[model samples]
Target: MRYVGWTILITFWVALGAALHYTLPQRDVVRIVRVFEERQDLNDWTRIFWSRPDEQSDTFISRDVQFLQTVRANGRPMVYRNEDTGWSWPPYFKFDTSNLFTEAADATSTRAAPEWYVITHYGWRNEFLTIFPNAISLRQVDGPDASKGIPWVNIIILTTIAAIFYAIWVRWRRFRRARIDPTLEEIQDSWEAAGDAVSEKRGRIRRWLDTWKAK
Candidate 1:
């Protein structure tokens, strides 16, 4: 039972971390190799990775999605899907998909004269599932060696969440200690006092019965 409890606790934290990592915005420094558009069938399970440009049109099952191909600093190829998040999850409010595609196209460079870019995106790429991270924005940088500073957005978000949980935990402890614990203690003391009173009454009755028998 102890082992099972630990396993469940660890699993919950791991799952929470993965969910936050996938939903939060992340940045990648890479060289834009190419930009293009492709028609995608959104009727499958992979549709979750895609976006709904029109919030009211739930019947549309397929659409054309723009893509940006890039090579990371480690010489690994990475692809990003350019789509408008609209008023959906992650809340990027990205309605400039077309403009972003044009910018990515203009930033495209070859291996000889590599133009590096800092691509701001959110989501994950799973080769087996054919899901790519959605590129939220992009900007040209000096080179592949350019320093993409720390993720302040993620830091702030995580810090705020931690603080909220901590506050709740502290309040709960105070409530338990100040109100709940004292009430339980009072109830226990009253029950013990009543038991003692009943025991004393039985002892007095036995003493009275012995005196009558002696007479």
Candidate 2:
């Protein structure tokens, strides 16, 4: 039982961490190599990674998705999907897809004259699954090494989650103390009192029988 309890606890935490990691916005300082629009078939399971730009478009299985190709400081290639979240999940409220595409196109640079830009995005890149992270915002930086800016967004999100959990725990403790524990104590006291009353009745019956036997 103890082992099972520990395993469940560990699994819950691992899943929570992975969910936060995938949902939270992260920064990647890289050089934009190219920006292009490609028509992608969104009929399969990978469709969840793409954005829904219009309500009527949900009927279509394929659509054009803007992409930003970049090379990280470590020379690894990274691609980001530029799509408006449009008051959807993650709540980025990004509707300026055209402006973002324009900015990315203008920011394109070669390896020799690398113009570093921080891409603020959320999601995961899995080549096997063909899923790319959705870019939320971007801004030019002085250089690739120039302070990879702090993740204030992630900090705020984590702090809020912690506060929520703390509040839930406090409420649970109060409920247990104020309601659950008191209820259990009352039940226990009633059981003990009933047992004592039964014992007193049994003693009186024994005394009455003993008096009859003596007579």
Candidate 3:
């Protein structure tokens, strides 16, 4: 009974916390650029799309699309002046080079130029890669990414539900065993051990046995 009460209390607190999270305005920016990738036999074209903070619709930008085209044609890396600096790409795709679009910029790249469309914050860019690992060409909502160390409210809700059911099951099991074995100590031991046992018929039988024994 005590364990059950504690479990219920814990579940309530968890549920309340999750509700708060869902209701609160998202302080962290949920930004993602929808890179529409169209891979053809000859070339792969990618259109860059960006979303402002909590914006309903996304805006299209062509920085990545142009870079991809230029890189594909040149075979050598094309330079873009980004943030008053210049950067080059490797012949092959490396994990280090994967972030080239976001951070480094070429000396010739202008901050206000069309070429820097995909050069937003790393957070937004990562949001894009998370949803569309192999995305071809289209807009996609950036769903939750578990690996990013962000606390997911959905996971918390599920865990709370599981805890509630588990508590109920354990309590019911203890209640049943107490009648069959007819002892408090044994019931306590079994209840602690079983941790998840609940049957309606067993409960009814336990009640009948208790009444019969009492009479």
Candidate 4:
């Protein structure tokens, strides 16, 4: 039971960390090589990986998904899906899917004259699952090195979340110390006193039985 409790706590924290990492905005420095749109299947199981209209997400179907194909500075391929987040969980409010696609298409460049771009996106790119990160926005940079920008937003967000959790934990400890601990201690004292009284009564009964046996 103790092991089970520890496992549950670890799993919960791991899931929360994964969710936060997926939803948080991440920037990547890459060279845009191609922009293409392809029809994709929206399966029931994979619905969480894709962004769609809240109503249509429940009923699965096929739709055209715009992809921005690019190569990282290390020559690794990175493909991003352009989509509208609408008024949803991560709350990017990205309704300009077509606009972003056009921008990606316009920004495409050849390897010789590679134009570096930093794409601000969210989600995970998994080949096995065929899930791509949704590009929130992108901007041209001088070079791969120049694409290094300070993530002040992420810093502030994480700090604020930490402060909130810390505050809650502190208050919970205070409440336990002030109220719950005293109540539990009192209950334990009462239980021990009752047990002692029962033992004393049993001793008297045993003495009476011994006296009767002697007579």
**Candidate number with greatest TM-score:** 4
Model 2 RMSD, rounded to 1 decimal = 4.3
Q: What alpha-carbon RMSD in Å does predicted model 3 have with respect to the real structure?
A: 18.2
Arranged by lDDT, best first: 4, 2, 1, 3
Clashing pairs in 4: none
- Top of the candidates by lDDT: 4
1-215 in candidate 4: lDDT tens per residue? 99999999999989989998999899999999999999999877787899964677657588888999999999999999998999877788888988999999999999999999999999999999999999999899999888458888889989998999899999999999999999999999999999999999999999999999999
Report every candidate's CA lDDT.
Answer: 0.89, 0.90, 0.35, 0.91
- Whole-model alpha-carbon lDDT for candidate 3: 0.35
TM-score of 1: 0.80
Off by over 4 Å in 3: 1-147, 180-215
Please identify which of the two predictions, 1 or 2, would achieve the higher TM-score against the true structure: 1
lDDT for model 4: 0.91
Per-residue lDDT tens digits for candidate 1, residues 1-215, read 99999999899989989989998989999999989888877766677777766664356677777899999999999999998888887788999988999999999999998889999999999888888999988888887889777889999999998999899999999999999999999999999999899999999999999999999
Query: What are the models' TM-scores?
Result: 0.80, 0.79, 0.19, 0.90
Which stretches in model 4 have alpha-carbon errors above 4 Å? 57-60, 206-215
- By TM-score, rank the candidates, best first: 4, 1, 2, 3
